[model samples]
Target: METTEKSVVRRFYDIVGSGRPEDLDEICSPGLVGHAGAGSNLAELKASIGSFLEPFPDLTADVRYLVQEDDLISSWVSFTATHEADFAGVPASGRRVKFAEWDLFRIRDGKIVEITQYCDLFTIMSQIGALPTAAPA
Candidate 1:
């Protein structure tokens, strides 16, 4: 049997990279929430995502692992991007950064009902200079 997690992640990346935002509304429930600890709801999550990716217009996620249990699907992803605009209150640094993350999805009735995810915030902040860079010995 094909793993749902792998298929979900693959479709998600394809959609996010090239599909319209409206497509998500069709595949996801209107009451969908992305309460990923730091995020409280889908709206907040969307805004946070906007802030976090403000600098990386060309961001791309590379899938490494995909696992699922019952209705939940999880995937590990590595992303690469170059900072060119403000992100999460940090000015662009023109630095190329790569980071890893996990996206956990909740599926129901053949559609995504909810989603929660985690990412490497430190890598993003440091790359954008919001966090001080370590000094070389």
Candidate 2:
């Protein structure tokens, strides 16, 4: 059970990081849902991933930690990407940005059923020059 759960989670990252968003159907259930401060179903989640990838064509996620228990997997991921196109209304800065996220997934029957993600958006915005920087000491 643990191995299967872990494998499902790993495969999700592999598919997304590999820029094969079209293959998400292989890992995610038709009823898969996402709860990341907002609710999103499978279709919306796929579209969101597409939008993100559009801006960072070279985006990559490095899983720093992954733990599983009772069909639930928790992952701490660090993502790095070069800002080459407009993202969320912010124009491209041609700068590389890194951000961290802690994500939780629930899997059933070898398919991801639900996901909850917590990310450091403020830091990412600051890195992309969207947010103001701290004052120098």
Candidate 3:
């Protein structure tokens, strides 16, 4: 059961990172909801992901860990991308950036029904020059 849950979560990331939006329906429920720092629903989540993918065409998420308990899966992921287009009103910086995030997913009937994410948004903004960088020591 744990292995199945972990595999579902892993496949979710794999399909997402592969830029295969069409495959989302197969893994995610129609009523999928995202909480915390992510979107609110499946459409919103897809749009958010699309926005990121637009700027970072090669965006990829590396799963540091995936732990499952019953219907819930917790994941630690590191994302890496090269800024090649505008993002969140910031022009392309042509820089490679990496960020880490923690996510919790709820799955039922072999589909992801809910998710919550915690990510370093400030660091991402700083990396993209949207936020001021720290002064040298």
Candidate 4:
């Protein structure tokens, strides 16, 4: 009878937004799949996260809202960090970037079994200089 989806969401971010990469086992399922972005499975997801944040060791996620129902949690969050390592084939630039994202997670057996996430890469890429920005006329 502990309907605490918001608390679960906070706990997840406390580990992910603050803890080291090795903490994935504490939050994600063994075969978790992110359906909205790259990184096919849990292993891939962890590796990708580690590699992406490698350059920006100080990555931080600022949560704006959390919505939950049954065993599902949805979050609206903005993450900020400086690029100091390779990310998605883009070399490090040491540029500070901030981007907002939506993440939907399905929890089962007290762990996240599946995740569907969406984020704006164009904003991040532009902020990191991986993509050219349009100039105002």
Candidate 5:
């Protein structure tokens, strides 16, 4: 059961890395609830994924760590991409960015029902030059 849960999350990263948003419908429950920003449900989740891919078509996610307990899977992932289009009100900067995020997935009946993600938006904005970075003292 634990392995199956982890595989679902692994497949999610695979789909995202390969830029196949359509596959999400199979693994995610229609009644999905997301604790992450703007991804409150399955449709919103798919839209947010599409929105992100529009700017970073080459985005890839590497699962740095993964753990499953009960029906919940926790993953720490690293993502790399190049800014190729406008995002978050910032014009394209043509810069490569790497960021790490922690995600929690709740699985039921082999489908992802709930998701929560924690990422540092400030760091990502600074990396893409959407926000000013301070020089080291």
Candidate 6:
């Protein structure tokens, strides 16, 4: 049971990194609840992912850990991508950035029903020069 649940979460990241957000329907439920303001439906989720992928076309997710407890899986992941296009109104800086994200997925049957993500936006923005970084003393 745990293995199956973890596998679903693994596929989620794999599909996202593959630059095919539409394929996520295979692993995600139709009524999935997502974090970071992603839409509650699969179609909306795909659109949201597509928008993000448009800017960072080469985004890749590296899974650091996948821990399972019953039907829920917690994943610690690092994503690396180059800012090749405008994102969130910020022009592309051609910077490569890596940021960590802690995500929780609830699996049912064989599909992910919900996802909660905690991302390191400060580090990502700082790396892309969208936010000012403090100098080391």
Better structure of 3 and 4 per TM-score: 3
lDDT for 87 in candidate 5 is 87
Residue 47 of model 6, lDDT score: 92
Model 3 weakest 10-residue run by lDDT: 1-10
- Model 3: which residue pairs collide? none
What TM-score does each of the candidates earn? 0.81, 0.91, 0.91, 0.82, 0.92, 0.91
- lDDT to native, each model: 0.71, 0.85, 0.86, 0.76, 0.87, 0.87
Write the residue-wise lDDT of candidate 5 on 1-137 in tens digits.
Answer: 44989999999999888787888988999899998753789888788788889998999998998898999999999999999999899999899999998999999999999998787667779999977577678
Task: Give the lDDT of residue 61 in candidate 2.
Answer: 89
Q: Measure candidate 2: CA RMSD.
A: 1.9
Screening candidate 2 with a backbone cut-off below 3 angstroms (N, C-alpha, C), the clashing residue pairs are none
The digit string of per-residue lDDT tens for model 1 on 2-95 reads 6654465577666554424445554566677776632656556555555555568777778888788898888788988888987777677898
Residue-level lDDT of model 3, residues 1-137, one tens digit each, is: 44777888899889878977667888899999999766999888787777778888887999999988889999999999898999888899999899998999999989899999898777778899998677778
Give the residue spans of candidate 4 off by over 4 A. Answer: 1-3, 135-137
TM-score of 2: 0.91
The residue ranges of model 1 lying beyond 4 angstroms of the native Cα positions read 37-41, 135-137
